[model samples]
Target: MDTIEWQDFERVELRVGTIISAEPNVKARKPAYVLQVDLGEFGVKTSSAQITAHYSAESLVGKQVLCVCNFAAKSIAGVRSEVLVTGVYDDENRVVLASFEHPLPNGSRLA
Candidate 1:
């Protein structure tokens, strides 16, 4: 494993955001969703996530998720992905979203 200074870790903008909307990403070769996240002061951002194995568009709405907010925007499939919705792969190799049980304000930095 590699170690990093606290400052280096702090530089990563890990924030919580609510899923405002989600829909299938038709252009993606693999099944995926195009999500619109409400990031409070940071505004709404878009991301393409391959979480179909454990999530559905209807189930994701109103869910609060962790996001890597500082990464540069990139085109994923046909969507212009902005923030990176954080998650871990399960034993089945399916993505399980990093989520919060209690509601947190959108754009709240992870500390």
Candidate 2:
């Protein structure tokens, strides 16, 4: 794997955020959800995620997950994606969220 300098890594804004709402993204070709995340000082931001294989809209609410908060907003499946909810692809190729065992304040930066 290519290695990045600490400064390069630091440029990424990885933060903690909680899912306040989630709903189906009917316009997406593949199954997906539109999520509104509460990022504390950053306020609520929207994201389009293809995590329907393992998560339900109801199950995602109140769940805290790691996020990439500084990425430029992009359009996805007719939705405005403001943040990327971080996760790893499992054995079955489904995304499993990167989450904390203990609750952390929203918008808390990863040191």
Candidate 1 off by > 4 Å: none
Model 2 poorest ten-residue lDDT run: 47-56
lDDT of each candidate versus the true structure: 0.97, 0.97
RMSD of each: 0.5, 0.5
lDDT of 2: 0.97
Tens-digit lDDT track for model 2 on 1-111? 999999999999999999999999999999999999999999999999999999999999999999999999999999999999999999999999999999999999999
Candidate 1 lDDT over residue span 1-111, tens digit each: 999999999999999999999999999999999999999999999999999999989999999999999999999997999999999999989999999999999999999
Query: CA shift at 34, candidate 2, in angstroms?
Result: 0.3
Error of 1 at 95 (Å): 0.3
Q: Global CA lDDT of candidate 1, please?
A: 0.97
